[model samples]
Structures are given as C-alpha cells and as structure tokens.
Target: MLAKRIQPMVSQARRLYVELMFQVMGRALQAVSEVDDAVKKETQALPAGFLFEMMVMPNGPRLIVEHTGLGRLHYHGASAPRPVDLSIQFKHIAHAFLVLSFQEKTAVAFANDRMLVDGDISYAVRMTRVLNRLESFILPKLIAERAVKEYPSNLHLPHKLISAVRIYLKVATNFVETVRA
Candidate 1:
C-alpha cells in the first residue's frame, strides 16, 4: 500500500525534474551557440528552418532548438509551433537527467537503448556532434571528459576559459533581453 501511494508522487517529481532540465538546457545551448563560432559552423550544413528537440517520453518536458539560418541556432519556446524536423527522446526521466547532468555520456545512453531519435540518422549524428561541442564549452574539463567520447586535443585550458566567460555573458544578456521583451 505504501509503495503504491509513493509511486504517483515519485512520478510527478520526475516529470517536474524533466521539465526543468529542458528549460535549463535550452538556455545553455542558446548561450553556447551564440558565443562559439566553431559550434555555429557545425550547424551550417543543416537545413535552414529545421527544428530539433530533446524530450522525455509520455508528456514530460521538451526543448526545441531550431536552425534558423546557415549557421544560426535559436531556442524555440514551448508555446511555439510543433513542427519538429528531428527529435531525441529519452525513454524515461532518469535517463534524461543522467545525460543532462553529465552522469552518462549521450552516446552510451543511446547505445544502451535509453533514448529514441525521431529523424534522419545522419542529421542526428551531426546534432550529437554539436551537443558534444557545446558540452565541452560549458562543462568543466573533468566532467566534459566523462561526458564526451573523447575530449578534443586542440581544446586547451585558455580556450575553455574564454568560451566559458563568453557563454555566461551571452546567456545573461539574452536573459535580460527576454525579460525586457
């Protein structure tokens, strides 16, 4: 009886957590892409006006990132249209959080059947590479090493520091603009 009573609460908490994860990731991706030219370049080959999303299954939180131009990325809000060109969906909230928290590398999670990709495989691979690049810029070296398959040899400490600073500044500025608008 106690287990049954607790299950619903646990489910609700998990749902909330997944939603929060989407919000946080959306903002961070926006910041990183805004500040990093190389990261933007990764999206240049993608189709313009294409939308990509990362979501949790069964009505959990979802985040959408759109390729607005040749090399431009934008965070599309929940209130926006639902015309997703590609989506990566976690099978469960725990699986979603594990990757979001950098507790598990995304490729490992995907290989373990923790996620589902609802789009072209080639495009998904390109997006995965972009995510890895953003992770390198935003996460600490130690955490990023564990999160990515292999840290880039050329990403020296000074570059990481500069990128981090730029990301933070851009995020803050965007936040302020969002509030004003």
Candidate 2:
C-alpha cells in the first residue's frame, strides 16, 4: 500500500523536475546565444528560422528554440508557432530526468538508446554542441564535467564564474518576464 502511494508522488515529482529543467534550459540557451560569442557563432551557422525541439515521448514536457538569424536564438516555451526542423525525443520521462538532472551525459544517453532524433543528423550535431556549451555556462564545473562529453579545457575558473553569473541573470530575467506576460 505504501509503495503504491509513493509511486505516484515520485512520478509526479520527477515530471515536475524535468519540466522545470527544460524551461530553464530553454532560457539558458536563449541567453547563451545572446551573450556567448561561440554560441552566437554556432547559432549563426544554423539556417535562419530554424527550430529545434527536445521533449520526452508521449505528451511529456518539451522546449523549442529557434534561430532567428543575426546570430540570435528565441525560446518558444513548450510549443512553437512554426514547425520544428529538428526534434529529439526521449523514450521515457525517466530517461529525460536522468539527462536533465546531469546524471547521464547526452552522448552516453544516445549511445544507450534512451532518446531518438527525428531530423537532420548534422543539425542535431550542431545543436548538441550548442547545448554542451550552454550547459558549461549554467552548470557548475563538476556537474558540467559529468553532463557534457568533454568539459572545455580553455574555460578558466574566473571566466566560467563570470559567464555563469551572466547566463543565470538572463535566465532569471526571462522567467520573471514570462511570469508577467
């Protein structure tokens, strides 16, 4: 009886956690594209109006991002008006939770068949790079090291610290504006 009662609560908690992570990640991506030269360059390489989405399968939380040209990215909350150019779907919410919680590296998850990609492989590659870069900015060095395939050796502590602060500030501002809207 206790197990049955706890299961639903655990599932709900995981779902909420994953949903929140996706929202923050979307904001972080938007902020990083604006603030990081390397991220901007990566976004610039994507076609104008390109849209990328990541979600858990079967009615799970999702995030969509668009390359709006001029080296900019826009987060479109849980849905977008335009069709997605690239979509990555996790097989299960638990799989998504593992990745979003930084318990499993994306590359490792891919290799383990925890997710599926439904678009151009090259574009997915580019998006992965952008995500890795964004993760480095928002996550602590130790956690980022585990989350990304490779932590950037060139990113020193001071620079990473400053960039993290800026990225976090932007994310917070975006959330506040979203609440207001």
Q: Write the per-residue lDDT of candidate 1 for residues 13-63, one digit (tens) a residue.
A: 867777766775677677777777887888888888888888888667888
TM-score of 2: 0.98
What does candidate 1 score on TM?
Answer: 0.87
Candidate 2, residues 38-121, lDDT tens digits: the string is 988878988999999999998899999999997799999999887899999999999999999999999999999999999999
Alpha-carbon RMSD, each predicted model: 2.3, 0.8
* lDDT (CA) per prediction: 0.82, 0.93
Error of 2 at 79 (Å): 0.9
Candidate 2, residue 30: Cα displacement in angstroms equals 0.2
Pull out the clashing pairs in model 1: none
Q: How far in Å is the alpha carbon of 106 misplaced in model 1?
A: 0.3
